[model samples]
Target chain A: MSTPRTALVRLVAGREISVKLRDKGFLASTAVFIAIIVLAVVVPVMLEGDTPEYTVAATGHAGAVAEVAVELGGAEVPGLPAADITVIGLEDPTAGAGGDPVDEAFLRGADAVLSSDPDGTVVITAQENVPGDLEELIAAASSAVTAQDVAVEAGLSADQLAALTSPPQPRIDLLDPKPSLPVPPELVIVIFGFLFYFTVLTFGASIAQSVVEEKTSRVVEILVAAVPVRWLLAGKVLGNAAMALGQVVLIVGAGLVGAQAIGEGDIVAQVLGVSGWFLAFFVLGFLMLACLWAVAGSLASRIEELQSTTLYMQLAVMTPFFSAILIRDEGPARVALSYFPLTAPLMMPARVATGDAAAWEPWVAMVIVSATAVLLIGVGARLYSGSVLNTSTRTRLGGAWAAGGRA
Target chain B: MTDATLAVQGLTHDFGQRRALDDVSFEVRPGRLTGFVGANGAGKTTTMRAIVGVLRPDAGTVTFGGASMTLEVRRRIGYMPEERGLYPKMKVAEQLVYLARVLGVTKDDAQARAASLLEGLDLAERRDDLLHTLSLGNQQRVQVAAALIHEPDLLILDEPFSGLDPIAMDAMAERLRDRAAAGVPVLFSSHQLDLVERLCDDLVVIHHGRVVAAGDARALREQRAGRRYRVDVGGTDAWMPALAGMTVVGSGPEGTLVDLDESADPQALLAAAQAAGPVEHFARTVPSLAELFAEVVR
Candidate 1:
């Protein structure tokens, strides 16, 4: 016979794989979900409008550089006086002589850098503390600078320069149609969306399934005979978490590998730090939902009642998704959801991915989520041990709590 | 060496306000097969779980090897729960070896032991089949083998005969008897009273989480023998002869039953019955375990 530790691992892993693979509905759901996310990413960016443009400003030969600025910014080259945008041109009056209030004002106010040069040099700079849209702004400014150089080299006449100055509006059609969210970090949205949805669906069912299976099969009697309720819970939590961790690695690694394989370089790193935080959320999320799942399983006398009993667990999972979706664009709610433990795994990662998360937010959110996870695991173990053997009618959440005090 | 492989005292477990097992006590000695007999929900499983240290009793202690059950004690105990659990996807051989490993056996030894067990149970051919693919009886054999692969010193099997056919039951009984003979303490609960009677030396009967009766099976059976008696007659007759303190349990045409008074002399009771008719047959019998169970449970 195998060693107990190996036996436990094999039993757990074997059981998990069987249950996971046997349910075609689950596999199908996961497949369809992955397809939806892939399409969701692929469809929007391909058919959507101009990859949202951002304006840039250049100084030194101000007017001479405006053309390059617009080309570089990947937006319309503002004619003479730009509308909805003010591209100030400065000569530094005293070239490198310390304080020029006009240059300083425009430098402090600019939103992003486009390009830089000296004499006829184009110095594209942003005054804003952070780039509003760095990728778009940088792309536009580079294109603008390239167009200016072409015109200057060609020795184009004033009218010719003006005509050429309009810097080709990029006839701007991307034919290959790769989704705009092209990086692995960009897939974070899809990763979190898929994992958050599927993890809850998959792992939540594992809990309920194990509970109901044990009850229906009458295995709970034997199990409770040998180990503390806590050990079972711990073993299960570890087992299912391992499963989730595997999925997390698969999805993340697959996305990273897929992105790199397709020439989408180094996107995983963008989301690596955030993914670590995502795991913290997953642990917390699992803890909260595992409690509900176990409670649901205990109340269910048979497998048929398992689905019905898991309704509360379903609702719990949906709360975070609904919160994430509805107040997603709102910063405070996103921040709140990020730290709310149950919602953090789903919401905080999205906020971090979208660049909406503040510096201390993820850390604070992690602390709160971790504390909540540890707490729920303890409470879940207690409730599971208490009510697992009570094959009576459905146990209310209160009953599990009451069970706690009984022991 | 410990005389009793396991000893449980004042074990109690409660779920909410209701107690599932209350102050139950029992002892299982090496070289003995102890039967835990009870109807469904009679706290036999609860008591066993408490003894195994799986379900912590509210007030009690279960000692193995003369000390409280610890991880070490658990490793040495073979437990077959009523609820048969095997990883459905795992091959039977793989499953057994894994269990052996969990009990601290080396992989090679565990594998060899598992093979022998499978061969013994006549499941060597199906060793590679996933547990779910096996018939229920075969799966049950696998469960048994899994429990015994490590050759534990203390074996606790809860309702081991729940689903086995008669032949399988006999095989299981033989296995248990063999193990007990080898100085392993075997404690098992079963609704099959006849099997328990045939296989067990001692019996612990539980009712509603309490030990109702616990002692040598023969002694317990003898306790209720006041209702047993034999009558003698020369020929078969329709009428049953009545005697003092005796009611007719069964009567042939030739004779009547005279229940013996516990305080009365058996020789006098037999003489009284013989005075009414020519003596032919004389037999005093205690109820079978089944009858005993019915009486106790009722």
Candidate 2:
């Protein structure tokens, strides 16, 4: 009796997935992915890498404010939540007599330099526009120094000077501040981008390699005879995609568990939120690339040919990956990448994680990706069926398509 | 025309700018072992592939039981492709069961049959071993067992005996005979004419993508044999008188083997030979399948 197509596909899929379960490469990569995720949250907290560091160079009376500047910067420089500033005191008398303080400051590796002109007008030098916190810091430092000098010259003791004067600094507030995560948003994008990039490349390429293995080994002859070509294609894509998704879950689950363990409840919730969308957009997106990767596998008849055959798929996987992270903040580019089918998988969920996506935008991107996946599935099947039987080891896509027409 | 019979009629196929099979036609009747003979690239594999639907012919129909080939009908046929298409990474029994299930056997039965089939092929001890771990000859045995696991209705094996040792060959021959004895049509291809002569009940000869000769093996040999007689008379030239009505095609040892003229009669020749001396041996000659194959292909 003839086997039902679905039944045979299920059988093939079961074998594929089971085979991958035993694969050492797959298992090793899964462990690596989990470690990366867990480390992304853990390393920064342990290192206390959150505080921003700055350096300033100065000389003379204008440079004298370095002391007061250090005092205020130590006690929470207003706009910068946690910041540290170091002032380098230039002792060369010639530095102020005939040299440019800005040039000297920059040569000394300072972010900004303070110096007094012969006319005794205080000057600050910075690149482009000075950063806001540093400007506020410099201005307050200048005022407090001037006040200290005036009060101290009146013959009051240092204790009396301290009693009457404290550095009163400028404070400003914003109506909207981006919500922060335990891990930076950029790190979140790197994690998401990297997860999609690695899983798709690894899983998709494996799907193709399996196809070539069947062909080169010629076992596909028996398989193709027993079942329709489409079923073989379906079984492989579905089975490997399932493996890829399961590994994603394990890696992300480990991440969430580790996050919560470290008391990063926010990281857990944020990843959990984006991953729901990640998985939603991811399942179909991975399928499209999986189909393309399968087509790549079918094009080659030898294991040697697989490297060349899979090149385009690697590029396809890479472009969107770099795009999602590198151009995430570029408005039109991010929006375009979010809507583009190949990139939608990475872009949509990443945008949501970075809090750039509107509520309804991911929904639209998901629909587009789902549709493109359907289209790629059809094209992949055709290319796969056509090229798979060519014993020549490599054939043009059009040739395979035409050949499949006859089959 | 019965469902147990396999028929290939006017089959044609081409592999871009080269014709692989052309006007091919033949039949494998039930309860017969048909040997398909051809040189390398002589369309033997192509015809087998076309029969099993692995390759679509440019024109022709492969029918079983008087109906056109279908997936169900294909399932009923156990086809072993020429290239030995079994997975090297899979365990022997697991590979066999998997192949059988794809051919429509239930998993439990497939497993049972695989175990017994491995036992029969003397591979029972290697059942759990991966296919690549086996010797080439053993792998060949497993390849054959792969085709028989489902106990198919018809058997079409391509170069099935190419790599078997003599003992393995006999075991396989016995198994094929068992299938044929059960009234299944068995079609297989081989370049070994001696083996074919000893084993095949039917023969199909192909050369240059065309079917040159086909039918019951004995009948084909007889059909191609010429009128001839072997005679001996006291190991002497005394039967030279018989040469009047015949031409000596060969002469040695116990006789002169002669192809008779139209007017020559075997009885007349015998009488003529005895008139000269005591006739020691007189018998008509029949061609062996090997000779007939050479003659037909030549």
Candidate 3:
């Protein structure tokens, strides 16, 4: 025969899971969240621009300039992608300027058009929505060729002309070396911090709300009579934890697949490599806070009063989120938070992701969090048992403790 | 069916300095419906709570089938609190099955039992509906169904008949009788004395946190019966004034209710009434449960 306590716990957990899964609001919200993950992954791939390449059409005297311009434009710019410039010779020499309007096909094929007016002014016509960098590249090429022409006309030597046309390069040496802080890891850390904060807050409040609902409806009396109070608490924690873990996996999995499809797979891989640590911390952290949520819920007799009663729990969850974001770069603060169980779950994973903590720090934090969770479970169970059956008004924590002790 | 007897002995409890129950004791025999009648705040709820282990009494104990009420035995008993509670968001059938499963019933068995209970309560058609959607009367039936789903050895219901209509009351009373007939002791608290008088085989009357009266329903009435007699005669009321030890309390078209001293011979009074005219009726009136409750409580 099964132990009645275990059986009772399983029954309560099963009921919680089934009821929440059947809630239309929960289903709709989860669906919306999944859609967001998909979009976050796919939108970047759609927005990534291809290698920069430009085709130029030249006529008459501008052909020489165009030739030199194409060579220089094709060279890589300091901070921009290298441009590929192709000069298509016009048979009429003035075809680009006055002979006939360029056909739609040519306009579509060439990025820009170049021609010389009869008075000798060079004109460059670019396509609509040409990026600023591309326009700068074309201008630099044209100016270089023009400068070379003027130098040649003034009888300057080849060396002088080259010196005049080329821009100077500056060089410096740093006394101290700094590690490169890549944009992706920083972005990932912030995102993970928020994820931890919101997940804990939302689910924690949910646990509290569920408890208060049962209390207000007086269903808890029947429940307490049937099963031990601690077992009921465990069942609720387990049920919500299962749901929370499912949500985490869905989000992380979507993120990884999206990152991979967009060629940012390495960043996601690095994040996932440490996600095991994140998962461990999340479960421990959520369990620790979830216990308090159950206690907070038991204190309130009605749903309207639930919010005020659970405010401290909400604030506790938010403290870590804000601390992680505000003190992200403060090494000492991060180290201190990593040791504290309340903030450790949010901070430790981020520290590991950013390569800021020692290898053993996360393990230490995990141990501390797990121990704290056990302790809180005991305290929370007492509170739950003490106040769960009292439906008269708000139950004080101390009163509940006393009641629980008597029981 | 297990024959279970519930016994509460010297159960005393307090809320802070206020005494909720004082030396309360009662017995519910197997295969009997015991009505726990008490006025408001008379410790009925507290006594029931103690029996179910929801409240720890400062003194005394509740025993089931000759054993102290342990978790194992508590599981074998069903309790419905004064505040009827069921998950409003849960379907009627599912909620019943869940409660049964918590008590260690197999899932399939729980489901079958829930279905049967709903059918018996005339709620089979509404089984799939959420509890909050049902009328209060239907919900009361579902609450009753929840309490009975596990086929507990003892049934404890607090005010199970309060919000029920007459039809629902009849059904609930019949169900309780059926359970008792199966050898399960049923202890229920209610302020509805008429229904209690009609339905309960045994009555436990509580006043000021004490068991003032208990035992067979008819026996308690006969025990509490005073020396009051109702006499009907064909002729006048003049003879009533001449009676020495008998005081006329009430007179109606049917008869005159006389309060006789304990030393007064009722047979002599009957003869005198017959001599005056034709004796139509002469009998002592038995106290109602309500009258008994009022008398004991006062």
Candidate 4:
């Protein structure tokens, strides 16, 4: 009558997956993450890369000033093509075609109009505000023209006037410089480490909460009677791990695809290369902690009690996560930490990012964590098996382990 | 019958230093509803847990169909713990089907069984509702239905009727009876002796982790009766209390009931009742199951 243990495990795991898939919170959070990834990738491309161009409508004297302005402005604007200046001629008042031509130029999309009044005062007009660069250019041109004429009248040569007009600006420096932002490699490592830390805690605590829920509801008793205790543990751990891992993959996949689509292929290659290493570490690390989370759940009989029982596991996951983030330099300490199984998931990815990890370092670290995680699975299953059944009393891990020894 | 009898023999368990069960033994025979009675903490739950393999007995053999319990046999046992355990968020019908599926029932069979049990228990309307949304009495009915969903060969229910309303109790009792009639060995523990007395074909009384009394229901009553007699006199005359080695146990419109010591004969007590006044009626009265439980427990 009984089903195989693997089938029961599969059934339980499937139920867990289906339950989370049906959860509104899970779906909503997943959606939010994808949205963030899309926005992060797409927003920047839409905002940059525009070059300003100026079109001016000018009569006789102002036409000369507009040409000079273009020359000065073209040299000043960095990282953009020189702003092009188009000058359209209009009839002078002497021709008796007065304000109409100015109005005509305005209809033709001229950026600004320049002219000289009968009294010889300069006039510059824009229907809207002119661009800052354009305005600065025109003002500089007006002053330069007046200065050059005055210098010639006063018998100074063009070279001398040009030298005098261009002032020598002193260079400024900071006494204390802040360090540069993280390089792409380190940044990716930090991001990957952060995701690993965040998801492990989130999914781990969720697994713990669910376990306590089953214990409190006594649904676990029914489960225990029908299936082996370890199978339930294995199912729950694998189920929630799947949720966490899949979410991580979904979020990263979304971000990476968005990045690749928008011509951020450099980023795509940077992240994609080390992704396998981080994922391998992530699976091993997540697998190790997920078992303990089940233990945390079994140790506490009530939901409220879960907070205290789960704290140790929180510390266990958090310590290495914080260490990986804080220890950025390439050194013996970092290298040793990367090799340590508990710290490896967080540290090795960072080392990989910094190019400090050798090609085989991650492989060795993975082997160590894989061996440890597999070993801990047995221990966690024992603790969970011992504690989950004594539902009436809030079973302690030690008590359960002792009882597990006897049973 | 031999193939279907769930025989639990010499079931002994110790919790730390405390002996929870000591040489407990009983049978849930085929085609009978066996009522298991005990006081609180009297090892009914422990014995049930042992039978279903939830708790390992320190010493004992639990065999079904004359073979030691295997995974196959254990799956055939439908056990409900003293505490009600079902997913509060899960739908009623879905939960039942899931339990049956875990026991290796096909999806079609599980679905059909779930629907049928729900209809029979008057919970068809609430089948899709979350378990917590139902009233507690209705939830108890669902718990009983869960045990029956797997079409189990043996049903062991602990405190299955404790929280049931009268109507819900009757519906569940009917289900258990139906299962028994279908040749399943149904063993349920309860504090409600009257209900047990009315429904049970056989009884097992455990006190202090020991089987104090167990037998065919009517046969137990017969064996424990015949020591007391009821006599009705023409007038309100109390004569039994004055007689030697006789005690007046109760007085009613019909008679004065007297308990006779070995020296005081039941016939002699009847004669004394006639001498006091013209005797109207005289007969021996058997105790109800409630009285039997109380006497056996004492």
Candidate 5:
């Protein structure tokens, strides 16, 4: 009898594995999405070029400064020529003096505007203000010219005034490891953070969908009749866990192979090794979530209710992504999420990548998560067995369990 | 007597304030096909689900072979649920073997059984096809094959004929008969009264979640031996109330079908009806199962 049961469980697992592999659209699309993430990181790093160009818009003296900067190696904002700057030298049309400020007119026709007043002041008026980066450049140039005028009033030689206006070679370090700029560790953390959240969400959603389909189709009914609800649910969680692990292995392993082929160092291999831990938490994490999803599926009478029930589960998966945006990888906010079972599946991976999580903490956290998963499966199985077949308007937990008690 | 393969004793299940099954009791013996007949929401599926441990009843118990339907007992009972469900992404043969293997059949045995059942059901040609790729009727056949693949000692089917064409229905009926002849107890519910009459050895009729009538099929007919007369005449309805100990069951353009009490003579009923109006046809006969169902439920 035990031998048969063991074979039955294995059979279920094999069926699950075979079915997922045969689902060509899902497997292919999922591979495509993960590949896009890898490309998003690798393409930017692999490009052998200067940093991205920043577009600047201006006119008159500001335009001259921009042109000089362009000659000094800055790229111009494409499509708009210096016609607006040439027109700005015209008199304002609204003024009785016939100063037709074509720059302002051009700015009006344009999505934005730039203009200068007669009192040596520049006033920008447009449907929308320019971005602050361009505005900051204009402000810096204006201050430099004002300082040069002050130097001329001091009766210094023109060369001396030019000395005062000497270009501020600030010797800024582009590689300054500032608190604001992202570090390599931070990038690694961000990558794993996204992977953790999305993998749990995608795979967990699949588990929920599978459960609902089984219930809706009445397959669970026959299955429950044949085995204890525990074995049935356990076999499903274990089976799907194996399949999800297979997909993760395929994707992450392929990434490692690609990285090695390109001599890109072992950073990807390290990430893949870290993913083993992520996958560990993910299995326990998925088991916990899959139970809740199955419970939700059992509670609902129609397939339409699936999305609403899963909305909370999705939020649980997304909490790590949300917290990462607000705090440092090791910050208390994120650390707390790492310890939380619902959020740990995503959070711990982020911590591991950033070196915020200790070697033992993640394993301990995994233990907690696995234990909780077992507990939830028990609760979920009972609720599912009690109410899955009951199509009444109400199958409250109280009533669902007591239904079979009297008999 | 042969073992009572499945038994329900005073089973009562409630949903909130309403009762889904009330004091329902019946026995299905080996080698007999028990036809469970009921209208919509009449608890046929509920009872079947309860027996299989899919739904727990609020009161009473269901026993298979005089033993309570534990997990082991359930493994030995074949069940075809009312709501059809197959993994749409799974291949036909793969799903069949999966279900069979889950019932504790060895992997090799399950595969062999699945192959034979697919061939028997004329589904061997499409064994490798995905379930969603099949036509609706063919999918229904696979569902039946899944139920029968393990070949348990007892079978419970709910609305098995709902989606089948006439040919499939006959095949299903033949399968049930064969299973019964092999000494496996089979109980099924259907709305096809004629099929039930022809296939069932005993019948159980439930109305509003209560058993209103039950017995051997032919014996039930014998028990309702009160004479029924069809008299083709004018003013049959008007003449009905005048007859002593007689009731109007139904009437049509052909004639009025009246049931006479056991003490009332069929000859007297026809004589009185003819005296009152010009009679075109007169006959005394037994009521069809359809009519008996309507009469009992009403």
Candidate 6:
């Protein structure tokens, strides 16, 4: 058996959820947001056009050069296409040549033409811009072949010659070990930060708007008489919070699925790794702002008056969002923001994404934000209960506080 | 069914420097329809609000059934504010059920009650429609239903009949009587003195945040009526003005309206009128509620 207050709160929350779910504006905006996330994920995969096939028409020694180029260019670059090059033999260096080397290469059914002069000058021609990796490969192959010829002429033994002519690769040793999880893309981290900011701000405004509507319409009079004021406030916050959380889950889930489908599994792992922290921070941060929004809403008797009354609260939610954007790279600023209750929701998740904050920082920020949220609820509930039924011109915060104390 | 008496004692409230309710006191007895009547801005709404715990009185107590009005007590009280309001976007039936459930009724019971109330209010067809879509009179009926959905122990309605048509008013009056018959104390405020007088078993007239007069409706009328009389003589009475301690207030073909001093005898006046001519009719005239209200507030 639930207490009357608890039961009433649940009823209120249920009503809010049902009403919002039926609201076409809310549904449409959520659909639009989901569409954007899906498009963001799917568009890049669609634009990564089919793999190109490269044919190099080579004559004499240059044919050997083309094979070496293909071998070196096939090595993987993290986010670019795989190299696929085929070589074709030319019996005479100038047999199929014309004044325009590019035209001659195209007539020979090749992407590029490669030839070596007897004096050791190598010429490469292409009809259009060559891919950066393909150019690098051709340069490296020509240098390697020249070095091998010199090594053989210097009278080195077969083993020594092989060692001298082969490419020299530098070995790397990190002083600190790399993190087990790959860093999330900076764009992805920024997206999460904005998502937190937009959801909290929009939902917080909605809570205030609803409060003012109830007050202006005078439905709150009946509501307050039927139940405790705190219960109504609790119900509203919980209801809107549930809706906001659902939206966040949908967006985050869609992003993960899209990333995985596009073969960006590394991003998926990184997002999942910080998702717990993001959710915790989002919940606490939204609660903290939502309480104040309830207070601001109770102060205004009409929806038209809401903007003037809730200006300070709006600024409070926006300040941290803009701060995160402006001072994103400043370690000290991010550290301070991650621990500050107001900014922590926006900054902490970003720091986690960038790997700038240590493991313990998020926990500390969580504790601080949660504590602040509890305190805000206490004060916010008092203000709400006190001023909710007073349908005067407008309720002053100071007066409401005094009345709340007595209440 | 428990009969509860709602007592508001010395309730005082202030809005900033101005007094909204000043030492107002009244009682809504069990199984009685108590009409709270007052002029506009006379603090009737404020007193009602204080009784239901919507506004905390600065210095007073509102007790229901001999205990202070707590959340538990308020749960059993149905209140409608002077400014009628409901969630415009919500369906009528859904809104009623929500209000009922919040007051501790079971979900199924709440739904049933909402349906019954809407049916009784002749809003069965509009139950599924959003509240704002109804005409103002019909919406007012829905507001009344919302108040009665939980079948509260005490019903406090402020200006419940303000926007209602004659038929709707009668329906609301009938509902109030039914609630009172079921042992629920109903306190409602209205500026319409005629309807209040016709519907109320008890009358509490408030003025300037104070209870000016309160008692049984007939008793209040009789009390305000005082020693006034109307005597119909068979012919034009020439000697009526000569009576001591008595003044003719008005005279017409039917009768002469007379105002007598408190010590004057009504029997003596009737005999004198007969002696002058055949007394066709004689009776004490009771003051109407509007007249009583004007006299008291004045």
* lDDT tens digits by residue: candidate 4, A102-167: 777877788889887776456888887877767777777777776776788899976789787775
Tens-place lDDT per residue, model 3, A92-191, is: 5354454444443264487667778887777776657655655676566667777877899999998888778665777767786444442355676677
For model 6, what is the C-alpha lDDT against the true structure?
Answer: 0.84
- Residue-level lDDT of model 1, residues A195-298, one tens digit each, is 77668777878877887776665555545544445655665656676767676666566555654554446454565656776776776677667766776777
TM-score of 2: 0.82
Best by TM-score: 3
Candidate number with the higher DockQ (1 or 5) = 5
Give the per-residue lDDT of model 5 (tens digit) for A1-407. Answer: 34366566666667666766767866886689668756754665577323324344456655554444333333333422212121123234666345445454544343334445776676655445664444554555565666766787778888887667664456767774433322265665666566556666766766666667776677877887787665656666677777776766666666666665555655665666567777777677777877666666666665777677677778876776777645673677778878887777767776776666788889878877888888888777777666666543435667655542432
Model 6's CAPRI class? medium
Q: How close to the true structure is residue B107 of candidate 4, measured as C-alpha lDDT?
A: 87
lDDT of 1 at B264: 57
lDDT, model 2, position B41: 96
lDDT of 5 by residue, B71-149 (tens): 7778888899888877887889988988887887777998999999999999999999999999989998998898898
What's model 5's lDDT at A101? 55
lDDT of 5: 0.73
* Candidate 3 chain B lowest-lDDT run of ten: B235-244
Question: How much is the lDDT of residue B41 in candidate 5?
Answer: 92
| Model 1: per-residue Cα lDDT over B1-298, one tens digit each | 6465688889888867888988888889889999999878888877877777656678988887787777667767888876676666667898787667656677899999999999999998999888889999999998899779888888999888889999999899999999999999899999888888888899998888888888889999889665566575675564365555556666666466666565656676667656766677777777788878778877
Candidate 3 has which clashing residue pairs, if any? A60-A93
Distance (Å) between predicted and true CA of B6, model 4? 1.7
